[model samples]
Target: MRIIIERSNLLRSLGHIQRVVERRNTIPILSNVLLKTEEGAGLRLKATDLDLEITETAPAEIEMAGATTVPAHLLYDIVRKLPDGAEVKLGLNEGGTQMTVSAGRSNFRLQCLPEADFPDITTGTFSHSFTMKAQALARLVERTQFAISTEETRYYLNGIYFHALEVDGASRLRAVATDGHRLARAEADAPAGVEGMPGIIVPRKAVGELQKLLGEAGEDGDVAVELSDSKIRFTLGTVVMTSKLIDGTFPDYQRVIPQNNDKALTLDRSTFSAAVDRVSTISSERGRAVKLAISDSQLVLTVNSPESGTATEELAVGYDSDAIEIGFNAKYLLDITGQLSGEDTVFMLADPGSPTLIKDGGDEGTLYVLMPMRV
Candidate 1:
């Protein structure tokens, strides 16, 4: 393909899609980004890692309408180093084996893979389509992505689950993630056309990339979502991403969420988080338990290690329940606290052996569940 695209535009498009290209690939063509010149759509750039694909369009002057593939990262680096505002000229050799990149005094000759050799993951028909405000979607992802499980054994828990549910007679879209020890759930008003959409598990990788894109979109942007039982697509501005959904059933998360836990302990979020951090330092392992001793109106945080000395901190809390002592992973406690956006948090406790429910006072729709550990 021969096209003249502004350096900034080319770099932006490459940055959006090249991330999907894996550093090591068993297939030769999988390492390349496909560049195709169009008559009215400017220039099209695409990259894929078999499971996920990202495509973006950049404004360009098309000299010849054709297509070719080249190393994704190498081309991105070359374009990134070029002077700002320089026009990048891409030309395919007559033999169709090489392409030349020229901008002012800089030049790069890269081997080309025939576009015909690149495999396209066939996207089947979509069963559901909807749109969500970028900010709203960002909230759901940010609140729960940290809790997504990394254990490969429970493949379903390795991604965020998106489903539609009716709450108080109003449709709502919810995102849930769990790693057995902890769970996070966040919901927002369901967008148009999402009423009967089938639940889908978005793999961890796609969730991360989508999260970045949504973050960039800020508050005014909107993301168009189209999905089927097995595949999903997201369209944001000039970029389009398609991915295969994880084909596993997520557990009924409602079963683990405590229903009758009435013990409420309210404390300043920053204060509690800081205390947890300071006390947990006494333990060498992040998974070590940090004991929480709660009574009438006070909370004591303590950490004990066989090799290291014990550390403890106390803070006044708003609790009127019976005295209770609970142990939780230091890392897990910090994670849930970090996600809380409010000044104060309320933890609903049942017993030392059951899951504790944590709710963000600032965000009523977001909640977390943490399984207690024996100290």
Candidate 2:
């Protein structure tokens, strides 16, 4: 298409859209970013990788109205390296088989693909659409994304599950991710208008993409999230991202959460995390098990390995329950601790073999579940 756009704006949109374009493609058109010039306003840019698509419209001066596709990544790199604030002019050359890009003192030409080759997603019934503050979405993703499973056998667990639930008569949105050994759950107030929306699994790759956009969404702006049965869409001002949902049922995570753990221990989060890191130095290479011995008001973290001797560290806690010994993966414990936003953490224990429930202070909406290891 023939259009003139600011170099900075074009690069910003390209940076986001080109990431969805695959480096190696069986279809030639899939490797290009479709650019269409509007009659009087701006230009539209789109790129996809079969599963996900990103479209952005930016202000541009239109010459002749037309559309063409150029190499997605190559075009992005060229514009990114150019001087800032440069005005870029693009136009269809000779027989419309190629488009020329001119900016500053540099000029380049790229072969064009027919705009008809690009695929379109007819967004089906949007069962839910809502607006949420950017900060809330960021917090929801930060707390639970670390625990997403990477195992291939349990394909369903490879992504974060976004679902709505009622807790204490209040509507809340929860994000849960687990790899079987450790689980993380984060909750936030559910945005209005999505009370009955179906839960969906957001693949890790898509989650990463969304996070990048949300980061740039500005703290004051709200993001509009919409979803149908098969696809999810995120609209932030001038940018829009759409992706296919993972077709899998997430497990009933509520059942896995421990219910009756009465032994409560409160410890300084940083100290405990450091102790776990120190003692785990002697843990075995495979399991990386670290033992926790708690009695009266003292907790001792220890680890033993056949090749390496043993290590132990003591920390003062606020527990009055019967003395208990529990073992857990050092890495898992560290992850749970990393979620703590404050200094003190609360851990509930039933016995040496049961799951431990960890929470920061009295916050019940955010919790961590960790299975004990047999040391």
| TM-scores of the models, in the order given | 0.98, 0.93
**Candidate 2 lDDT tens digits, 1-375:** 578899988998899999999999999999999999866659999998888889999899887799989999999999998898899999997677998999989999999988988987745777789999988888788888889999988989988899998989999999999999888998999999878989999988888888888898788889999999989998999888888888999999989889999999999999999889988887777969998999999999889888889898999999999999999999988888887787889999999888988887645678999999887
Model 2 clash count equals: 0
Task: At residue 366, give the lDDT of candidate 1.
Answer: 96
Q: Which candidate is the best by lDDT?
A: 1
lDDT of 1 by residue, 89-139 (tens): 999999899999999999889999999998787458988999989899999
Off by over 4 Å in 1: none
Top-scoring candidate (TM-score): 1
Candidate 2, which segments miss by more than 4 Å at Cα? 281-285, 305-309
